[model samples]
Target: MSGVGKSTVLRELGLRGLEVVDTDDPGWIEVVDGEPLWRLPRVTSLLDRPRDRPVVVQGTVANQGALYHRFDAVVLLTAPRAVVLQRIRSRTTNSYGKAPAELARIEQDLRDVEPLLRAGATHVVDTSAPLPEVVLAVERIARGA
Candidate 1:
C-alpha cells in the first residue's frame, strides 16, 4: 500500500491544475520514538478549505474513522503485492519499506488495513496501469465522472 502510486497520481493531478494536499507532508507527520504519528488537526485544517473544486488529499491516513466520510468521493489506489514490493524497494525519496522490520509491517498493513479501506472506497483504482491511465482514472473520479 505504501507504494501504490498515490504520490505520483497526486503530482499528476497538481500538474493538471487540481488543488492537491499530501497528508504525508513533513509537518503533518510527527515522528515520536521512530514511530510516525499523523497530526489529525493539521490534516483536518488542510481539508477544511472551500470546496469550489475537489481537493485531492493523498495519503494512507484517510482510513482514520470519520475523516473518510468528509470527502465527496474516496478513491482507493491498489496494486498487486509484487508491484507494491518492487515500488517500495525502488523508491528513493522515502525509506518506508526498506528495512526488514518495516517490510514486515508493510506486509501486515497490506493484509490488515487495505481490506477495510477497499470496502469503504467510493472508487478503487488499480495502479498497475500505465501512469497516464492511472492519472486519467483518478482525475475522472475526482471530477465526479
Candidate 2:
C-alpha cells in the first residue's frame, strides 16, 4: 500500500485544481522502529478541513475503524506483489519495507491487512494501469460515479 501511487495520484489531482491531502505528509507521520505510523489526530484534523471541492485524502490508514464513517467514499488502490515490490524499491520519499523485517511486515500486510481494507472500500482501483488512468478512476470514484 505504501507504494501504490496514492501520493502521485493526489499530486495529479492537485495539478488539475482538486483539493488533496496525502496523510503521509510531514507532521502527520511518525516513524516507529523504521516503520511509518499515522499521527491519527493530525490526520483527522486535516480531514476535517472545509473544502469547496471534494478533498481527496490518500493513505493506507483506512483500516482505522473510527475514521471510516468520516469518509464519504473509500477507494482502495491495489497492485500485484511484483508491482508493489518494484514501487517500493523505487520510492525515495520514505523508507518503507526497505529492511528485511519491514519487508516481511509489508508482505504480511499484503496478505492480511489489504484484504480487510478492500472489504470496506466503496471502490477499488488497480494501480497496475497508467498513472493518468488511475487518477481518472479515483476522480470518478470521488465524484460518486
Candidate 3:
C-alpha cells in the first residue's frame, strides 16, 4: 500500500483543497466532519449535498459498491501482479502471520477489480509510472488541469 501512490496523489490533491479520504485510515469508518464515512448511507448523503467543491477518496477497492454511485469518477490504480507482490513485501508492516497468503489475496483483489474498471466506472490511472508522473496525471484529471 505504501509503494502504491494512492496516498501520495490524494495528499497532493488535498493540499490544494480537495476533500481527500483514504479508507485505510481507521477514522474513515467513524462519523466526523471532513472525514470519510464508509457506510453507504453516509457517503451517499454527503454526495447528495450541493457544493462547489472537490473530493478525492483513496480506498481499497473492496466493498466498493457502497461508494460507487457517490463518485463522479473512480481512479483504479493498476499494477502487475509481481509488482504488487513486491510492493506488499516491502511495505506491509504486519504480515498477519501469513505473508504468502496475504500476498495471494492482494493479487486476487487486483484481478477482481479489473472487470469493474473494464465496465467503466470512470478513469483508471496506472500507478506503475514514476511517482511524480503519476501525481501529475492524477492532478490533471482532478482539475481537468
Candidate 4:
C-alpha cells in the first residue's frame, strides 16, 4: 500500500489534465474516537459537484469503506512486500515510511488492512508494472476507456 505508485501515478494523471484529489491532506481526514475517517461532508460535497473531467481521489484510511460507493471506481494499487519496503526506505518524495515504527505499521497494515481494501475495490492494479504503463492504466480508468 505505502510503496504502491499512488502518488506517482496521481502526479502523472494531473499533468495529463485529469482532476485529482489526494485525500491525505488534513482537510479530508478527521479523527473521531481515536479512529481516522474521511470528513464525509467535505468529500460528499466534492463528489456531488458536476464535473467536465473525471476526478481521481487517492487516499487510505480506516473508514474508507464508508465512502466507496461515492466513487466511480475503487482501485487498489499493490506491490510485493519486499518491494514496498525497499521503496519506502528509498523514496524521496515522501518521508513517511523511513522510520522503523512506521515500517512496522505498514507491515501490519499490509496484513490487516490491504485485504479489506482488496475486497471492497472494483479494480486492482499491480504497481510492479513499468511506471509509464501503470500511469497509462490509471489514465484509461479515469478516462473511462
Question: Number of the top candidate by TM-score?
Answer: 4
Runs of candidate 2 with Cα error greater than 4 angstroms are 29-44
Runs in model 3 deviating more than 4 A are 1-3, 27-37, 49-52, 61-63, 92-98
Determine which window of 10 residues in candidate 3 has minimal summed lDDT: 90-99
lDDT of model number 2: 0.82
Write candidate 2's Cα lDDT for 29-129 as tens digits.
Answer: 77777766677788688778777788788776533556778888888899999999999988898787799999897898899999998998888999999
lDDT of 4 at 14: 96
Q: Which pairs of residues have clashing backbones in candidate 3?
A: none
Candidate whose lDDT is highest:
4
lDDT of 1 at 91: 91
lDDT of 3 by residue, 1-102 (tens): 334556667887777677777776764465447543466555566577776666676765345666677676767666666666666666555353146776
Off by over 4 Å in 1: 30-38
lDDT of each: 0.85, 0.82, 0.64, 0.89
At residue 66, what lDDT does model 2 achieve? 65
How would you order the candidates by TM-score, starting with the best?
Answer: 4, 1, 2, 3
* Ranking 3 against 4 by lDDT, winner: 4
Itemize residue pairs with steric clashes in candidate 2.
Answer: none
